[model samples]
Target: MEDQFFELMCEKSSSESANTSGRTEEFLDSSANTVDISENEEERDKMTNFLQVIESYTDQEFRRNFRLNSSTARMLIDRYNTSSFYTNKEHGGLPKVGASKEIYILLSYMANTNTFREIANLFNMSKSSAWRILRRVVEWLLSIGHEYIQWPSASKVQDNMRKFKAMKNIPNFVGCIDCSHINIKAPVSNKHAYFKRKQFYSPQLQVVVDADKMFIDVFAGEPGSLHDSRILRRSSIYEKATDDVESKFPFNSFLLGDTAYGNSQGLISAFRENGFLTPA
Candidate 1:
């Protein structure tokens, strides 16, 4: 996924260089005037159809399709609006699509698991347009979203003790560790590495979530065929756990995990008993 985003960014940079005149503020303003009134109405109706579909969804339906509740989705859009490239009026290039709506389009691509063509049809945009919107929004999210996430500090670990104990009688536990596969298009080269035993091609996404189910850390880009333990060992978070964090808060503070992650010094795994696993 990261590589794909970089490739898209490179493509965008090249395209921008070739179309300097088309992107000028005067050209953008006059381009709208060049279209006939009927064409303008048609474009408006297309956007309206897109909005109508979004509005018709109930709360659960909306969350199912977009993978975020309405409020969170709106909040993300508000954050995106802070970016100079995403704001509508001040930008010159193309007539801007809705900041909120374009975000919804990208989320639908990610959450609803649709192809670019399907999303384009749903949003009343061209296939290339949908792809461009997704690439841009993803770039922005990757840049800004990580600022809000931090690993549990020593005090934070201490504070969550009671809540962790109440949930499962576990003491001093800070977070859960797990890995899942994110499906992706087959790469042009080295296609064999991503194929898993389960007969799927994907990239492994390792995540650590605190008791509240918020992601504290994430590591991606490993091939799906790799073992969980190997991915964890290769991740920077694993290095932090062993080299830095373990000595400072050694007692009762550990990460909970499954058998796939193996027994490690700073991590705990469930015990295997008669094919069932007991909690660490």
Candidate 2:
């Protein structure tokens, strides 16, 4: 009776082992069949994330966050797509973040001057990714900046003459010139050079704007400590003015400016009375 019981137990164990082996083989077969679906799943996930980035915001929210209307932002994206430098390619080797989100990130950075970590937190991306997006977008924008901001041609300047004089009986006026300091953190190199008379660190941004407030030219990267006159002298516009004001601009056309600027053949400053210029 004992020998018969031991043989029965051995047979039961062998049957259970075969059943377990068969189950393992079935699971492997199922896994192999499903392996190709992972790529599709990844693509779906990317689309979901992209939609989530844009779908929640209205046009008003987009404008508030980016300082540009939704229409303008869309136009910029289209321009970037067609641009030879930025065309539908990811040359930076970074993972794909949707184009809309990338534009939003750049505009957010520019509009609010937010720090990189803050942008990363708001946009749900890594800090390094945010920085990479900003760097590439800024470089691309700089490359195309000349197309947007340029000196008006001789004919265009002549056309705007009447409109400019309408401001304050200032005839033959072309535009206004001014410089303002933009605050910045102390740089690792040349910290003292960036320190301004106002006891802050900054770089001076000199701008030439038409009476209609459209930018005609801009020069930046000058140390805040430099005088406005020194900055003006260093500008390419000033070089052009000094070279031959008559050939470059409309006959007798002059730029309007405050006392901070000097009186040149092409640039004119409002006359000062006593301590300051009159509001009139």
Candidate 2 pairs with clashing backbones: none
- Model 2 has an lDDT value of 0.64
Query: Cα RMSD for candidate 1?
Result: 10.2
Q: For residues 1-280, could you state the per-residue lDDT of candidate 1 as single tens digits?
A: 1112111111122222223222222222332244222222222223438677787888788877766677677677788888865856534465668888788887776676676556666787666577657756765665553444456667777766567888989787788889988665554446688889988776677777777776666666677899999989987677878788765345558888997777776688876676565554
Off by over 4 Å in 2: 1-59, 84-95, 275-280
178-225 in candidate 2: lDDT tens per residue? 988877666545669889989987767777776666666767666789
How close is every model to the real structure, measured as TM-score? 0.76, 0.75
TM-score of 2: 0.75
